[model samples]
Target: MKKFGIGQSAARFEDRRFLTGAGSYLDDENLPGQAVGVFLRSPYAHARLGGIDVSAALAGDGVFGVFTGPDLRAAGVGDLPCMADAPNADGSPCYKPPRPALAIGRVRHVGEPVALIVAETRARALDAAEAIFVEYDELPSVVETGAAMNGDAPRLWDEAPGNRCFDWYAGDAEAAAAALDGAAHRVELELVNNRLAPNSMEPRGAIASFEDGRLVLRVSCQGVHYIKRILLSGIFDCAEEDIRVICKDVGGGFGAKIFCYPEYVAALHAARTLGRPVKWVAERGESFLSDSHGRDHVTRLEAGFDNEFRFTGLRVSTIANLGSSLSPFSPFVATSAGVPMLSGCYRVPAAHVRVQGVFTNTAPVDAYRGAGRPEAIYAIERLMDFAGRRLGVSPGEFRRRNLIGAAEMPFRTVLGSTYDSGEFQQILDLALERSDRDGFESRRIAALQRGKLRGYGFASYIERCSGGAPEQARLIVGADGHIDLHIGTMSNGQGHETAFRQILCEYLEVDPERITVVQGDTDIIPRGGGTAGSRSVPVGGAAIAACARKLIRVAAGKAAELLEAAVEDIRFEAGRYHIAGTDRGLSFAEVAFRAAPQGGPAFDEIDEFAPGQATYPNGVHVVEVEIDRGTGVLDLVRYTVVDDFGQVINPDLLLGQVHGGIAQGLGQALLEDCHYDPQSGQLLTASFMDYAMPRADDCPDTDFSLRLAPCKTNPLGIKGAGEAGAIGAPPAIMNAVADALDADHIDMPATPRSIWKHLRKLAP
Candidate 1:
């Protein structure tokens, strides 16, 4: 492989600047004559709004302004729109209540923004916000998913009876039921998927200003163009070109920062009204209370197997908590985004799923890391392990019997997903080999002698990725010899700079240093799809590759003219264009300079890649754990994974993505849980002190390897790798815990205390 080429493990060039504290983030931005703003949040989970007394806050020293929901409403500002909605079983649109930028009449959850306080400094804004007092009449609240779905639960919206957003179902329920009824063996399990906070390194923030009658927003977000469109079409009724969004380096998003938050809209309105820049950055505590969360679902899964242990049918019923209100795309996350992967890597002929989105008095739950894919995979894999144990069969053998063989390419699943390619069994076998599955018996015996229980678990998972909007790329061979590559997908610390530059290197045959990646600017790039659903590489990178190929074709034509050779005779190699049989040639840079001579035609190419179908990235994860019976402490002794992510752009960057995802999966499986007070509806785990994030010691040294099975859906033949680790880790680890305890079933976040209680209950 060529150094710094597609498959090479090039060192991340952006890391040096990041490590040296030279990265620009939302909080790092400071504009001239900029004023700081803070939100005054509600203290009650559910309450009726009475009267707001913001007179004192508005009169505070150095206070620029104070804005409320009514004020915004009076200005003709629109509500924050929910971009996605699922249809009810009756085909009616789901109950979607208006979500204003600020609290309109009643506050549904604690920390709902009531007013925006703008001052000269952050401290002054905060102090002014504290002085704004509002009268509240507390109402009964429901926090749990199941409780919210109950008829007796407090009605969040009068339009949505029983606090239900939508009653949605996929696949043929009759077919799944018949398959299950005729099966030789069956098993069922019910569990909670647990809510979680995103907790990115930098909290969500934005800086907004008005320039030349246009609103300019600099925010920590996943996509700039997406934000601009949402602001114009959803919040502010302005022309598309009236707003420009620019995002620089974002610490992390994990799907939480993809939407148009009220702060962004309020800041823009404030800036336009005041004729000065307005900035708002969430504090750590504020982020916990307000940032979009993930994965709060109560699901009951039932599966049936034939006499030969082949998967006959799968049925799932889930109540997904949408939290206080619906965030953009939240409705689809638990429905279409995940329902398609209900069977995972198995070849189930019949499957059905019923998902009812419910509203609860808590932070809105949206996509995080693997989003709905993780929740779906966790259900199937855990059920597979449980069904195997019930049928007196090994987990590996059971999975092997039902795995979708490579020969079954382009298999149409019962849940509506058509998998293009995968080697599920081969990946599983590799993971088992790497984990020393055959030797597990001996290890278990040795551990038994030491008063420990050793168990091994397996999880085979797949997800539909690279299925979203098209991505655009524009390449400009600058007059200064630097190749500028522009794409719409913004990087939230996913190493896009390195991975994208590598793609350019393979086509341009130029040094990685000569390419500059420009993204997250709507003004610079006309359009983009932004980075979500792990589509950056498969979708955006493909666009870059296409653009580079176009550039090379154009350059070859220009090189032939400069070399005085026929275009057909021009051979491009190692960044040099030469005649077939002569030494007469020009370096790529030299040709670029000459092609775009001071007064000559400029060299640039624009391209877009819209994948015809989504790629299904599949993987298998095997975990071995030792549980100390005395204290119910579990140690993940070994963890192995083999994934088929199609074509990898940068091996080193791929590993980093996998490692980070595993750490998050580990946190969700063993430590992290976003809890709300059952009676008070208050967030219990609001800070790091209450919530347990996985430390380095918590994540095992993962034994990871790629089992290449190139996807056929995209031009580059690359599947998404961003969410794979998180999707597979949860079920593998949970199955291991179940094996150690010899329990029929258990929910996620198997903390030490919960395990100890389970053991004590089983003790003689």
Candidate 2:
């Protein structure tokens, strides 16, 4: 591989515009004569809708439209369809509740959109929205996941009795039971992976315009093509081609923007009815209420281990809180995203996992950064540490003993996942070396002198990306000698433009600047599965490379014809096509010119690279923390991560992704939680003042390295790196805290109060 531009830490090309405040996000876009829409949300978690008196709101000055559920229903709009579906263990279909764009006869959760008030100005629409009267007969609501599964709790969905969406389990149960019965030592722990708000810098927004019998939607979404299909076929009952979904410069998605929100439907409907563009931008509070929250699972785990600290079997029964109506991807999240990755990087001989997707009176829980992998990592790694203490083995040594070895290539776990490739011990060794695990006792002693507890934590985690499905790309070499590559995957902050450009430049041997990457426009790009599950590089990047190769072939053939040489005799290298034993050659630009007839190139090609299966990216993370015993305030001093992402496309962007993911994971481990009052269903932490997001000062200096275990699945050998940091960081941080206090257990968000309470319990 060339060294100049392919693998180096090139500074991001998009950062200059973003840092200078010149980036154009959806909210920054303003159409001529655009009206603002403010949604009227339900305050009660469960309530019967008696009636909505919109007369006063309609009388408000500058109010153009007030749309409710009945209006949408009358307009022939259908409920948003769940994009992902999975069967139960018994082969029965999973329970899927109808998710209406606007609340129909009942409101199942707080902040459920009931009506949209469109006016000439944002403030006016908000004022009109406040004036709308909604009469509701409040019903008993269940906010807790466990309680929701009980018979006493009021049912949120009749189809799913006891509010249980599915009783799904993975792995061999009988074998796992037998292993547990014969194990030398057993350990059990109850854990909670707390719910979290994505809280991307820019809130969700949508601008809709209808003209010439066509609907154009510009929104802050991760999947524009997917959203177009959903809106046209599901929501508006229009043809997919009749609607164009354009996501222009999204601020950040982090899995929150991957779903179809009610605001989008409302904005589009308002524009169609009013014959003018309508815009709706969610406020910070609205974003907190509406955007999908992630990782609310109450799990009880039991692990069986032998005398040598080898894991024998594991059992986990978890209640996943899928709030109110199902989010677009809720079913898949519970079944596939949350369940498939239960076995982390360990070689457990047997395992059984029963995940019950339950309905609660709260915001819907969906994929966050690491999605299910983080929760699974927390459970397995915490149990590993606990087992280590019980077995009198060091945490690092215990992990090394049980980690899936390199010889276990194409290893299939009891949990039904075939890990294509990994070197789990290598990453752990690298992480330990980077963190200097041997010198940790001295650091703990130094911290103890200052009345602090210092400890280190380790986690070996694995994740599968590029698993969702196939992705498509279209690339063409234009007459101007520049290549235009169009892909269906949209970029939120992963630097797709720069990363994909590098792939194209490497394959085509063209200058990076000559390749123009286009994305997020449904009209231009072909069919594709949008970016999530860290599938962009292995799936989408491969698709882009496939297209580039096709373009090179076409260009080479044209050059052969122009040079009057046999196609096989012509060789293309470094953007030039030459004949064997001849100095006569044609530059890429000259070849493109020769291919062009009176108007343009003779042929334009598109390539769809379909991958067989997902690639597994595994890693180990070591976190060191200092706890102030007096104040119970924990400080993350250092975080070291060694990941096996198969191969590196861009080291700088990959590191940035790792850093950002660690921030989110650390927030979940020590700082962030979405708290709601059980009685009122009122959100306790709705703003930044209450929700503690990790800032620059909150994060420690990170040490990161990649273990080069190239995946054999993809052509580029790149596994997913987007979610690895989040998956590994949580366990590492939690383990470090537990090690610091020498405590047996600590809940997530190890808030100061929780830590203080644990300390009190531990003290004599």
Candidate 3:
């Protein structure tokens, strides 16, 4: 690979500024005469609001205003919108309750914002917020996903019977039932995908100002346009042009910051009323309570196998927790986002999945890193291990027997997902080889000598990249031999600056230094489908490639005129244009300068690209673990992965994404769990002292490689790699742990205590 071009490990352009403390994050941005705002949150999990007295807070020193839910409603502020649409299995509309900017008649969860206090400083805002008194009649709360549907469970919404939001059905349910009934063997397991807080390095925050009857919001979000649309249409009921959203640099947003929060709405309302910029940033504790969480599902998985041990059918029924209310993409994540992937990398002749979205007294749950794909893969992979154990077959061999083959080029699963291109068996074989599968016995014996139990596990997963949205890219070729590229997708530490420039270098044949990447501003970029679903490189880069083609075509016409040759006779190569069979030519800079005497861009073009279908990124993960029998301490000994990501942009950044994802996945498998007190609904893991993030030592050195199988559906022949590592790591680690313990099954966040308890049951 050439340096500073596609496939090369080029250094990130934005890191220099970030490392030098010059990155302007949301908290770092401030306007003149800005006031600070703090939300007064509800202390009870579920309560009826009788009255709110904000008179004392408004009279306090430096307190500009204190607003409640009634004030917002009186000002014509609309309810927060839920953007998901999934009808119930019986074809009825999904039950959707109104969610206001602040608590109105009732508070369903602890930390629900009840009032906003704006003052001269953060300290003053906090002090004023403390003075507000609220009367509440507490009600019983349901905290667990499985228990939300109990007959005696407390009801969060009167309209939703049994606290069920939507009971969705996907795939061929009748066929799946028939296949399972006819199968010779069957295995079942009940699984729990633990809830997790996003924990982005920079907590969620927003700065909003109202000037001249217009709203300006500076938020740390994935996309400015998304925020603008939600606030204008969903919350404020203002015209599109009435709001301007700006996001320069974000510390991190793994899907948590993608939605419009009530804090943003309150700040905008306060700024308009006080005639000053109002800013609100969550404390670490506030983030634990307020930020949307991920992956709380209680699933019952049943797999049917034939006499020959081939998978015949799969049935999955899950209770997906939607927290106290619906977030933007909560229903979609629980249903369509994950249901199609239940078939995994195998050829299941029949499959059916029913996900019931349930409400509970906790924070709203929505998209995380892998979103629904990780939860789906974890369930199927764990079921694979369980089925293999019951049939007395090695997990690896059983997976091989059912694995989809390379010959099936456009294989469509029974669940309706079509794999564009993959070599599942080959990837699995490569993972096994790289992990030294044959030598595992020796390693197991060595561990046993030290009073440890060693085991090996495998997880083969296929993910449907949510790149269906169109992305826009605008390119400006300057007269000074430089290019400015503005794109729609924003980077939350995924290195869009380096990777997109590499795409430009490949097409324009220009030096990387000559190109500048611009993103995250709605005013500048016009329209974009902000970064999520691993679509930045696959969909956004493809748009850049299309825009580059248009720029080249238009530039060629100008080059033909400059060369005094017929348009068909002109040939362009390496940033130069020449007449066919002649050496006479003009450089790109010369042509650009000639076209624009005022020294501006010679060519400006914008292109929008949407792939014909979503790309499928498939891979195999193999993990080896050693456990201390006496203490139930597990150590990840070796981790190996073989992925087919279609095309490579920057190998270094790709590795970084995989490494970070694995760290988070490892945390979910062994350490991280968002716990709430069942009786009180108080968040137990409200700080780092209680929440266990995976340390550096928790993740082992990974043996990673890629099997290049360019996607057929995407124009750039690339697939999404953003969420692949997180989708594969958890189940592989859990399977290895189960093998070491000689157990049939276990749930997630297999902490030391849980592992010890399981081991003690086996010792007797």
Taking all chains together, the TM-score of candidate 3 against the true structure is 0.99
Candidate 3 residue runs with Cα over 4 Å from true position: 1-3, 597-600
lDDT of 3 at 118: 92
Order by lDDT, highest first: 3, 1, 2
Over the stretch 203-305, how does candidate 2's per-residue lDDT look in tens digits? 9999999978999999998888778877865688777678988887888889999888888887788899999999888889998888999988999988898
**Residues 563-615, candidate 1, lDDT per residue (tens digit)?**
88889999888889999988888898898888786854358789999888999
Per-residue CA lDDT of candidate 3, range 201-288, in tens? 9999999999789999999999887888788766877778788888989989999989999999988988988899999999999999
lDDT (C-alpha) at residue 706 in model 1? 92
- Return the TM-score for candidate 2, rounded to 2 decimals: 0.98
Ranking by TM-score: 3, 1, 2
Better of 1 and 2 by lDDT: 1
User: Where is the poorest 10-residue window by lDDT in model 2?
Assistant: 1-10
